[model samples]
Target: VQAGQRLLIEGAAGNVGRKLIQLATAAGVTVVTTSSARDFDQCQRLGSQACYDYQSGFGDQLVRDEWTFDHVIDTSGRVALATNLDLLLLGGEVTLITAPKDDQFTFGVRAFYMAQKRINGFVISHATVDQLARAAEVLNQAFSAGQLLDDQVSQQHFSDAPRCHQWLEDGQDGHQRFVLLPD
Candidate 1:
């Protein structure tokens, strides 16, 4: 993200969202987030300029607040594609790491193209070597600046590997990064 651009992160309580906030804010981007009310303080600590509860018609709230983003990183698929399409500023993009498994998304192709807005999915493992290198440089810089989100890391014994996997699959404990310690 370029300096002075605005970005929105949905599921700001998630690990990726938190880390993204730190990185985006460090780069001088205006960062806003959507999450549960309980995570507002944590999101703020991560440098989000504002946090809206995703369950509470946050799309409408954003419109009312006159907030539009040049980019959006969606970690959770809770926000439908249509709504996100409407939220973008001209020539904006929405990058999705995850999305609904069973639903088919549709948007007006004409309007999308006319507005110069776009959407795409991202899987870091699938990134090209050059792209990865660029991302690593940024990640290293963030880590050196102490912007890395250590709080999202939770150490667990290797014996708990099964449990950790279950937790991730269940998605019931919210988002966290596992540091599996050797047994």
Candidate 2:
């Protein structure tokens, strides 16, 4: 995302989404999000310009509010491609960082192509060493500036990985990020 553009982040309360907010906002992009109502305040505190409850038809809310984003970063695979396409402005793009829960999704190829829009599947493992280095530099800078807060992180010993995994898999109540430290 570039300066002076708007970005929409789905699942903004989660780890990746929250980090995206800190980085994007720091880069001068306006950030907005779709997350649980409980996380609205936290999201805003993290620098999101607007927050909508994902459980309450956030797509409809955006439409009603006449909001359109220049780009979107969907960390959760919940929203459909067609729906995200509708929310994008001309030549906008959507990048999905997760493998969706559903095995299949469909969208109008015609409309997608007509608008000059693009869709990308993001995998950090696919990044080159140079790319990773560049990104690390930015993350380090952000961390040094205290832009990446510790309140949202839950640290655990490495031995507790199984328990933490189970808790996360079972959908633990909060959206806090987990960090596994050496035991």
Error of 2 at 150 (Å): 2.8
Residue 133 shift from truth in candidate 2, angstroms:
1.0
Candidate lDDT (C-alpha), each: 0.88, 0.88
lDDT of 2: 0.88
Q: Best by TM-score, which number?
A: 2
The TM-score that candidate 2 achieves is 0.89
**Would you estimate the TM-scores of all the predictions?**
0.88, 0.89
Tens-digit lDDT string for candidate 2 (1-183): 899999999998888898899889989999999998888888898899999988888899999999998999899899887778899988999999998777687888898889899998899999999999999999899888987764557889999899988887888747645789999
Off by over 4 Å in 2: 151-162, 177-183
User: Model 2: how far is 170 from its true place, Å?
Assistant: 3.2
How does residue 114 of candidate 2 score in lDDT? 92
TM-score of 1: 0.88
